[model samples]
Target: MNFANACRLTLLAAIWGASFLFLRLAVPSLGPIWTISARIGLAAVFLALVAQALKQGFAWQHWREYLILGIFNTALPFLAYGFAARTLNASMMSILNATAPIWGAVIMALIIRKMPTFKVCLGLLIGILGVAILVGFDRVVSQTGAALGIATCLSATLCYGIASAYTKLKASHIPSFQVAHGSMWGASLFLLPLFATSQPISTPTPVVWLAIAGLAILCTGAAYLLYFRLVREIGAASTLTVTFLIPVFGILWGTLFLGEHIGSNTLIGALIILLGTALVTGFNPLASRK
Candidate 1:
């Protein structure tokens, strides 16, 4: 890629990384389900307007696929991350989220009937080891909630992995922006009942509303636009690099703005996770074999 595109990619990464911070800020005021629903719903609106203005052909041609994508790509993962952030630091949650691509490769191999390459196998091993270390540290310190939060993040990432694979194989034909809009609409539908039952409106504050606005406009809407553009320009692997950068930006932002510490083990694990992901996603042994 050229220098401009590289900078754009980095900016996209920063936007996504900042999302963890915003989620941390927003979730405390607005509960997880409602927050996710609102932001994604707003994002959908933005996408809808853009699509209409552009005269883009739009339809939920495959309702089932859109539903599945909504669940895997946005609904499940978004809720998981939002809920987990209540218990875990954004730094920790973002670090754990870097596992999405690792899980995605495995899911792709299984569902698509492609065999797992050595790089993917190695990445799986490394990722598990890194997670075990995090869990072990938490267990020894009696921070069980943090461990569970990380596990929640992993579950979300697993969904992301499956969704990533599925999107690349099945939804590539659709414009990425349209896919984003459709997924957001589906997610909004799934989340509406939960938001109402959870009774978030009764509990929300002005700060919460402001947080929701930033989360919707800056993080979800703008970030997704950049993300879709990056994926179309550079393909999925390059797009997924934002996964690694998110944690770094999360930790830095948390430290700077929230007075959170950068623990040694967290840094070490982050490095290992990134290295493993790079090995898995950046190089394909199958391609070389072919």
Candidate 2:
């Protein structure tokens, strides 16, 4: 990778990593519906303006497709994760979110009616073990949260898995920016009724307001731009290494900003989870030794 892409990787990872912290801070003040609504709403407007300026605006040729994609990709996941953020800390949520790729593999296998390679099967097992470790020691034993929080976080990742596979099958031809723009708008519109009925605007402290704005603009908007740009520069496969780095910064930001505790179990489980993820994604270090 070039130096520029390296910087992109670092910045992208930091931006996304900080998302968990932002959600943790904002969710309490805005609540899930308003928080996610404002996030997707703001991101959509920002992306739309940029697209119009560049004359590369989203083509609404597939509104239905965008609607479905937005539901899975943005609306549902953000809502579920927002709710989970109330109970789960930034580090825990980030770690669980990494399970999205594993869920994607499971979803694909079911769709194709074929099992993964035995190596990938092993990776899946290790990933499950990692989750068990986190649940058993990090939260369940410590009583930081109950099963509901963990379940919601995992469910958010399930939405991610479904959205990813759906996008690949249905909307691969669309530019990434267009896809993000259309999906954000679709999600914002989809949540409008809920936002109106259930979401009351509350006065948060200026710090919380900053958190909400940062969550919307920086985490959602700029993060997407960085992600798509990296995909363009480095190819998608290499760009995915950002996944491994995300949790690192997630833990860091949580520790530094939120003053969240990072237990030994958190570190160990995260390492195991990333190892399994690497295997699932076709990383084979042992092969190099041979």
Candidate 3:
């Protein structure tokens, strides 16, 4: 990779990694429903403006697929992560997010009605072990809702896996930018009624507003643009390397900004989980060139 593309990849990872930090900061004050609703809603607006600027148009005929993608990819997972952010630290949540591709492999296998190969099976076992280690040893388990929080985070990743499979099965023909743009709007609409009824736990301060803007604009909207661009420029397999880098930035942001502690267990579990993800996805930077 050239230096410019490498820089874009790193920047994308840093932006996505900071999303957890923003969720943790905003969710307590905004509540999960309101926080996620605002996030997708604002992100939709941002992407719409970008689309207009680029003279891009939507595929209105594919609205149904967009809604399904929105539900699984944007609304459900984002809401789950928002809820998880209430009790889990940003570091742990980011690490758990890495499990999405592992879940994807299993889901795709079931979709195809085929048994997983030995390598995938081994990856699945190791992935589960990593989660066990991370949750079993983390001090956050002492918190009241931490168990549910971890489960919620896992469910979010499962939603991501489902979305990936669905996209491959039914929506792969749509351009990535169109899918992203349309789904954000779909998610915003899906969450509208709930957002209307929900109230924030407390009045949001400027910090919360800033966090929401960063989450919606940078993390959701701009990150999608960068992601699709990298896919076009470098190919999707190479772009997947961002998955391995996200947790590093997640841990760094949490420690430096949120003052979250990183135990030995966190490092070990992260390494194991990443290893399993690499195995399951067959992601290799060197091989991607072939």
What order do candidates take by TM-score, descending? 3, 2, 1
Whole-model lDDT for model 3 versus the true structure? 0.95
Clashing pairs in 2: none
Can you write out model 3's per-residue Cα lDDT over 178-289, one digit (the tens) per residue?
9999999999889999998889999999999999999999999999999999999988879988999999999999999999999999999999999999999998768754
| TM of each candidate vs. truth | 0.90, 0.94, 0.98
Q: Report residue 253 deviation for candidate 2 (angstroms).
A: 0.6
lDDT of 2 by residue, 10-41 (tens): 99889889989988888888787888888888
lDDT values of the candidates?
A: 0.77, 0.84, 0.95
Give the deviation of candidate 2 from the true structure as CA RMSD: 2.5
Candidate 1 overall lDDT versus native: 0.77
Please list the Cα RMSD from the true structure of every candidate, rounded to 1 decimal place.
Answer: 3.4, 2.5, 0.9
* TM-score for candidate 2: 0.94
True-vs-predicted CA distance for residue 26, candidate 1, Å: 1.5
Identify the candidate with maximal TM-score: 3
Q: Candidate 3: minimum summed lDDT over ten consecutive residues — where?
A: 281-290
